[model samples]
Target: MRLGYELKEAAKISWVAINSNRLRAALTTLGIVIGVATVSLMGSAIAGLTQTFEDSLSLLGTDVLFVQKFNWATGGGDWREMRNRRDITLRDAKRLERELSMAQAVSVEAQSNGLVSYEERSASSAAIVGANENTAMVRGFLLADGRYFSEADVDGLRPVCILGSSLAENLFPRFSPLGERIKIRGKKYEVIGVLEKLGGFLFGDVDNQVMVPITRFVSDFAYNPDVNISVKAVNTELLDDTRIEVRGIMRKIRRLGPGDKDDFAVNQQDMLMDAFMQTGGTIAAGGLLITGLSLLVGGIGIMNIMFVSVIERTKEIGLRKALGAKRRTILIQFLLEASFICLFGGLLGLGIAYPITLLMQQVFPATLAWPVVLTALLVSIFTGVISGYLPAFRASKLNPVDALRQD
Candidate 1:
């Protein structure tokens, strides 16, 4: 009960002290405000990027592996070797399909860019995907409307196409895109399917493309273009085995001898995820260092102001000690005062961060979660304790007679 009374008196004194010099307290906490705001905003940005990347991973297909001529994670030094490497071809995809027993599906995909036009509306430089019937299965593309082009469509080199959601909206805004004929590279093809919306990925927008049969793509666009093969595993459990099988078969298809190095690369969603994690870690480390410096500066400012406050309140400390105040009570009063200042600054910082987080949400998935808020507040209190300790301790240990003699 005595401890509670001391705490109450201490809090009352702290509040009055802060209220007496509102402008000074606000100015003193400016550093903390900036520091906390920057930390919160940076954290939200990293979280947003992580969430966006993870969401896009589903579209990349978890159970699938991509066979390509070059590694997706290759550095600049390896570019020359990759450039000289032979292009992954249709024959390699066919061989994989024929030999790989663990694969559920194999797809040959080629890509180019061209104008897609419907009546007067046209989207320029839209992505053009040359894909087989199994491409949808391997790449995890789902039809939003109508149906995917059949194997017959691929075999006959039929002028049938699938529109991405964004492209369909741009071309046929008012009605369904099904059965509507659109021209690709000046050749007319009927729209057989419209794909569900898939936002931006590492390469570019997935929902701004048109998919046609690989055979048709070869005939319409460049002849015998280099292609990437996508192989979907029979099950996720069989993925590693499937990858090994694919590598061995690809090596055989290329006719590499026992001592020859495998020229091909097998890529997966995990590779992209690993690259993103590394990038995120680097960014987080840098951001933490910058924010830590800001907090350190803020803490120093708080400590400086606290020392000044202790000197200014010397007479008051003497009077309180003379009136039977305990050493702990004096310490608690100054500590509470510093805490209130930082707590106010933390709240203000969050207010500033909230709107910025909202602006970031427009581009990604940034959010000010409760855990972040709680952490910021806890950090504020912790800073207060650290900054106020020296001054509070000195105030607690003052000689009443000596303090009273100070003018």
Candidate 2:
């Protein structure tokens, strides 16, 4: 009964404190509001970006592996390590295709940035991918219209091209692009097909690009005879064997001794994810540090306001004490008021955060994790309790006579 009565009295005192200084209470909560909002926003954005990357990575297929001059996922390594390396040539890719019966398909790509023009419309520094027929299967490209280049086109070095969806839209927005001729570096090529819209990847929009035969690329635009290749295993079960076979083929082509280390890199989607996660970890840590500082400042604001409240209501405290209020009651009252301030601010922050997050999702379709939201709320509550301690202690420790005598 005593504890219930004390709690009731504490509630009454907290209500009075809150109502007595409406403007001050609002001001006190401002820091908390900003802090909570920032933390929530940052958390949501990071989670959304992570989800976006994961989705994009999933599109690449798990069983596929890329053999390239430089590692795509892991960034720059020792220059000396790559200095003596010879490029993986079309012959290397051919050998792998012919010898590796266990592998499903092997494809070679020679990429270059060039100007593509159709009539008066043109795009400069556009991605021009050079590959054979197997390129589509290895890279997961789907034809929205027409057909991919065939073995005849590749072997004959025919001046035929496939347009990415975005490129097609940009160049020939109102009509079908099939049978139209586009110029690449003053060379005329017929658009044989249009690729489906693939959004954007780490390498940007696959749709806003052009693809031509490997033979044409090599004959007309081969900057170097050796370029990297991409190979896909028959299935997940064959991935290891395929890798081993590819390594042996590459070593033999390069004439590297058995004891020589590999001069090339084989990268996969998981490797990309691992590299991204490491970078993301650093960014998240920095964001958390900034958020922590903001939260600390907000907590201090709450503490300062509670202290001022205690000073302003010293006589009220004395009056309650004289009427048989316990120290614990006074402490609980001030603490509850402080906590209420933070929690109120947190609710407001979340209210604002939800809509902003929704807007972000609309702008960039991304997944928002609920755990992040719950964490933000919990942190705000914890901040309130921690910040209120000093003020509540002061209120509890005040002498009744002294408090009453204070004007």
Candidate 3:
């Protein structure tokens, strides 16, 4: 009961001290405000990056694997090695479809960039995708209107095409694009469907592209082209087994000897995700280091101010100690003052960060989640306790006679 009463009395004293030096308290809290804001912003950036990457992964099917000449995660330095790799062809895709029992679907894909025009409206630098019938099943494309090209359309080399949502809106703003003829590289194609908006991925907009039959794309665009094969597993649980099966069958199809290293690469969404996670981790580590420095500077400022506060209150501390006030009471008083200052600063920093977070979301993904808020507040309190400890200890240990004699 006495301890509780003493704690209440200490808190009251701490509040009075802070209220009496409002300007000094505010100035002292500047470091903590900056530190907490920095930490919150960094956390939001990392979280946003992670969310964006994961969303991109969803578009690239988790249960699917890509067979290509070059690995998606490979750096520029490995381009030379990737260049020598044998091109994955339509024939290889067919063979995989025939041989792979574990695969739910297999699709061939090729890409090019061209100008897509409808009347006077045109989207330049538009991605042109050559996809087989199984592409929809493999890539998880959802149609916003009309229908995806059928197997018959692919086999017949039909000039039917699907417009991505963004492209469709740009090309046919007033009316539907279904059955409308559009030119690709001057070759006419009827718009058969519109893909739902899938946002951006890597360097390009996901919804700023068009899909056409691979047969037409190959004949119209190039004489001979390297293609990518997408193989979807029956389920996510069997993805690993499917990948192993695909690698073995691809090696057999390529006529690679048992001792020979596989020339082509089998890529999965996880490969890109893992690479991104490593990069994100590096970025986060660097960001944390910078934030740590800021917090450290703030902590130091708090410590300095706390020491000053302790010295200024020496006579009061001595009077309390001389009148049967416990050392714990003096310690609690200073610590509470520091903690309240930081907690208030942390709340103020969060208020500053909220608008910045909203602005950041315009250019990139950023969210001030609960965990970040909780962490910032906890960090503030922890910084306060640590910074105030030495000063509080000093005040608690002051000799009453010497403290009272101070000018």
Best by lDDT: 3
Residues 1-407, model 2: lDDT tens digits: 98898778777878787887899989988988888878888888888778778878877778787887676565556666676677777877787678766667778888886889999999887788898888899889999999998999999999999999888988997899899999987899999999988875454658778999999988777756566577888888878887887778767776789888778877777888898899987998799789868978998989888788789989988888888878888888888888888888888887887888888887765444678778777888788888888878888888999999999
lDDT of 1 by residue, 151-198 (tens): 999999999999999999999989998998999989999998999977
lDDT ranking, best first: 3, 1, 2
What clash count goes with each model? 0, 0, 0
lDDT of predicted model 3: 0.88
What TM-score would every model get versus the actual structure? 0.93, 0.93, 0.94
> By lDDT, is 2 or 3 better?
3
The alpha-carbon deviation from the true structure for residue 247 of candidate 2, after best TM-score superposition, in angstroms, is: 1.7
The model with the greatest TM-score is 3
Off by over 4 Å in 1: 1-5, 73-77, 200-204
- Cα displacement (angstroms), candidate 3, residue 5, comes to 2.4
Model 3 misplaced regions, further than 4 Å: 72-79, 200-204
**Candidate 2 error regions (>4 Å):** 1-12, 72-77, 223-226, 358-368
